[model samples]
Target: MAATVEYDVMMAPEEPERSEEEREREAETCKEKGNVFYAQKDYNEAYNYYTKAIDWSQKNASYYGNRAATLMMLAKYREALEDAQQSVRLDDTFVKGHHREGKCHLLLGNAMAATRCFQKVVELETKNEQARKELKNAAAVLEYERIAEVDFEKRDFRKVVFCMDRALELAPACHRFKILKAECLALLGRYPDAQSVASDILRMDSTNADALYVRGLCLYYEDCIEKAVQFFVQALKMAPDHQKARLACRNAKALKAKKEEGNQAFKDGNFELAHRLYSEALNIDPNNIKTNAKLYCNRGTVNAKLKNVCKAIEDCTNAVKLDETYIKAYLRRAQCYTDTEQYEEAVRDYEKVYQTESTKEHKQLLKNAQLELKKSKRKDYYKILGVDKNASEDEIKKAYRKRALMHHPDRHSGATTEVQKEEEKKFKEVGEAFTILSDPKKKARYDSGQDLDEDGMNMGDFDANNIFKAFFSGPGGFSFEASGPGNFFFQFG
Candidate 1:
């Protein structure tokens, strides 16, 4: 059986065609070239080679997936998403296609879509560590964003920092996270922390306008106004359209102006000018507690110097309103009230000063004011006029008239002009006192602590000069006036 059968045994002509295998080899070669370009960061060339590989072999989902990755690297996220979708359509089981699509969505800032794609990849392959990690990162970013938004709205800057920290932990290379951290720290009044964060961001991105602007605000809060202005100016240089930087620069300049002007005025002993400048500064920055306190204190001192007793008390009251612990304001207000003859109010202010923790100088001043207030309560204006408590109305009038005649300027013609003017003022006061006590109704009203006009009306709208003339004038009778050098009296009613 083996004899003749070997005769016709000829090797079947080897099949010479391998078109599918050849195409696959060529696609793989193109794919390798694409990977090389991608590794070198030549995305355009990588994209071209990946496209060629995909065109040459439709069945290779890897080629489409790699092309999408290259597109994503070039920030052509929409196109990359389409290619990745095509790869998934070709073979839904391809893990790389799903990962690439997810990455594309992430690059496009579609966190929800990216999360869904990554989650699906994790679902399909439990051992897919990369997919699992991506899902976790995407979900953390979403949660952080949501919480941070709410925190920012509520002005809970501390919570904003905590949420952003978690986000930065998940995406350490995110520039936005760094910028947000700086802002949150600044809002929390952690100026030094915010400055450090902003500096780190600037190191990573020298032209980062938001980071520079935030750094400026941090510097401003730290009281480094000049340095803050520099940072804001730099930020404006980087981005001329940055509104925040512009506003910060303007505010910083204003603060600097106020500080300089106020310091100079204070140095020059211009207390009123200094007070106004400090007030302007406080207006620009209402939260500046020191400036507010200084302004009130300085204004109080100026009012005292100007002899505006009530105004001095009011300014000191405002100082206490701004800072209840201001011992100086309480003491100053007490002194002003004492000067204005407000003995009860002055006693109250002095009591506050006594209770306050004050320096030795302030304590001594407060003690002195309290003693003065006690003395003021016992002061008698009628006793200063040297009138007896039981003096008859006519007797009181006679005593005042005698004193006025002795000090009358016309009676001292040889005296200096200044002495004459002083005497005339004293004579006028004496006449006014006599007029108030001579009339029985006026005397009763005066004794009862009621002001009575010359016409026996209430003192409302009564002019002291008009009342004096009406009291001395009788109907159809003459009032005395020394009109010439001689002691001759001319009278007109």
Candidate 2:
């Protein structure tokens, strides 16, 4: 049996088990295949092959290094970083592995880690001037960014701008830094400057939310409210869950819709509805300057129509205060002052309106206010009540009741609808006159010198609005080509 077996295997020694040399050769063969796929830009296939090579020979640092590069192409940065670190650990002299680790750190916003890697790369290979440059850049950018963060938290936008500018100088192509600069500009109310920065960013990445929002603010500051809203809508569309964009869109739409409703209701003589709609618009976004001003002015009109004399005065005053250059607000306030018998104040407001916009209506209002001023200055309350200053209290009371009965709304059923409101106003005036004349102290106070101007009324101030706010492929494991960094840094997987 031995002789037969020897005869069968006589010419061939048993096939020797693969030695370490063969195992390493097989691993290199796999790694070479991975390299070919990588050169072909087939990153997934390259990654698979590289992983296979690692399985075959885990101690081969070149296999792990090559696999890390493949992972970076696939946008698996965190995993890439892990693999790269492992590669460097196994063979501390691997320059490519250190470079990849640095790139991964840079992408993840770990400037300190990135600087350390680059510094080590320079240390390992003294002739690597590119790595040396990267080290300095990372260190400088990290320091400036740290300072910018501190200033930003303090709301010191100027300081933030200063720090961000220094950072941008070091890494001019950083998209995140550009975005931060634009935001700081916006917070400082530098819309035009922010827009310029945002425009540059948009040219690089059109769908960037920070750029879109800053552009919208620019348009809004320019009084292009509708266009601004459209930009915000685009921002929201691009980032569906962006709360800031959502709020901007909602506020803009509500302002537009509510103002339209108020305008229509006012046109239809629905003063109550107009007032409510205007108020709702203001409540929705109290800081929208134009919308806030418009709602105030429009509500003032409604207040006047509904005979809310004091409320009308308050609304119109707020409207004008909010926007000194708003012609309509000044005109509305003038009218309110006239209704409240503040003829001097009315003339002052009308004069401002007349200076900017001269229309037939404004001219008539100016003349009327001037005439009322003359009458108000010499106003006689006892004569207004048809009573002599020396008339007995009984005589004054009887005279007021007679005049009140004649002008009373309830007694004016025969009057046209148009005249009935006027008659009710007259009735109230008659009652007011009666009360003033009947009260000895008030009558004496009025007769002495002053009109009853301060009736324990106070108007609150108007609320103002405060409005305002990557990748490329390249060397190393990461591409810095300025085209677009794929999902590598924030890899989906």
Query: Which number leads on TM-score?
Result: 2
For candidate 1, list the clashing residue pairs, or say none: none
Clashes of 1: 0
- Give TM-scores for every candidate, taking all chains together and pairing residue i with residue i: 0.44, 0.48
Error of 2 at 307 (Å): 2.0
- Over 1-493, each residue of candidate 1 has an lDDT whose tens digit, in order, gives 5666445667889967659888899889999999999999999999989888987798778888999888877867678899999999898988889998887766554568889888889888989999888887788788888999998889788888998787766555556777777887886667778889888878867999999999888877666788989999999999999997898789779977986797798778887787678678767765333345656676777778767777778878877886777777777887787777677787777667667654676567666666555545532335534688678766675576457557655566679989877876665666556655666776666665443444556433334334444545767643666566544353555
Worst 10 residues of 2 by lDDT: 463-472
TM-score of 1: 0.44
Give candidate 2's error at residue 197 in angstroms: 2.9
The local distance difference test score of model 1 is: 0.74
Listed per candidate, the RMSD to the true structure in angstroms reads: 18.5, 28.7
* Backbone clashes counted, model 2: 8
lDDT, each prediction: 0.74, 0.76
Which pairs clash in the backbone of model 2?
75-488, 287-465, 471-484, 471-485, 472-479, 473-479, 474-479, 474-480
